[model samples]
Target: MKKFVLVGVVAVCVIIAALIGTRMLTPPPAELDLARSKTSVNGTYLASIEPETEPVSVGPVHNWVLTLASADSTPAAGVTIEVDGGMPDHGHGLPTEPQVSRELGDGRYLVEGVRFNMGGWWELTFQIESDVGSDSVTFNLML
Candidate 1:
């Protein structure tokens, strides 16, 4: 019985080591662009995000401000934006369903209920629709 217990402990330690090793080996993409502003996938609009809180932390919901502008640098108003995101590496969605709660005018929208449960590579995608066109932009965050 004692021998069996010792073997089990060794196995568990090996598994833990392997898990940690894997995580350390596969870091976020080297070229991961962490820019707050980026152009939409279809080149229809330019979107930028600013977290309400400085130095975002895990746990506790927060808010973000999203600004939309045309490719020519004109503020895009009266637009509808949808938010969706998760940790790409973890293969899970965000703990909270963030949404565009209100428009702050001048092409800025208020995003509410943004939360990061874990520290890793996270993606926040915004699907924007306006009179000009419909497009999507994704931003990466590492917490």
Candidate 2:
């Protein structure tokens, strides 16, 4: 009689404590920061946008990709790509006209020596002129 009542009360208290502990111990999700990335390739550069890490930690311009192909947008092979925007005229003290290679398949291209030395927003000019046509795009980078 009295023992049963005591046991039930203890069980109820334990269950309530477990529920309260669960609520107090749960962790919140991590916040995110991001910057948009742009990519271009070949002799034709279009201002394409890419989602990037939010609140990007200031770092060197390690790897910037060039787009060679898309389901609806594709550039031909063997097309040359030139990017100019470091500082004197529009760069951070790098070459005004830098070159890269184009892979055989789509979505494949390269921009050699693409680096950002200091921390600041930088402009990028992508120029592509081939026997096919001429195209260019302008973008900005934050380091």
Candidate 3:
């Protein structure tokens, strides 16, 4: 009976440990803003992103339309934008190197080569440089 009790206690301890580990790897904060449109960090520009294809899924390449406007709501033309992103919780970058493949005029750019290997909390950051100034915006996505 004593041996059985000892084994049961050890099993309970292992289960507790596993539960704690899972909690530690929980998803991002509940209030993480998954907004598609937001102002740059320094208020230099307003940016928005929309996937060219709806219902983006894992293991597939996709495109996104990125639009930029001035703080006063004017189209930010001829701006240089650098695209980057990663899964914050997983500490891994995008599976593909996405870039501004084309300029669609009227402050819209075609960003291609965006891919998500696994679904989680991902952050897409845009480093934008315009005639006015330079700033960045990060958009959060949950998949």
TM-score of each: 0.83, 0.48, 0.83
lDDT for residue 77 in candidate 2, whole number 0-100? 53
CA error at residue 35 for candidate 3, angstroms: 0.6
Q: What is the per-residue lDDT of model 2 for residues 27-139, given as tens digits with 9 covering 90 to 100? A: 32233122233334442433342322344334433335565432236555555667777532222355324456434355445555455555555555667555556676666
List the candidates ranked by lDDT, beginning with the highest: 1, 3, 2
Candidate 1: give its CA RMSD in angstroms: 4.1
Candidate-wise lDDT, in order: 0.92, 0.51, 0.92
- Model 3 residue 110 CA deviation (Å) reads 0.5
Off by over 4 Å in 1: 1-25
By descending TM-score, how would the candidates be arranged? 3, 1, 2
Residue 105 shift from truth in candidate 3, angstroms: 1.1
Question: Which scores greater on lDDT, model 1 or model 2?
Answer: 1
Candidate 2 overall Cα lDDT vs. reference? Answer: 0.51
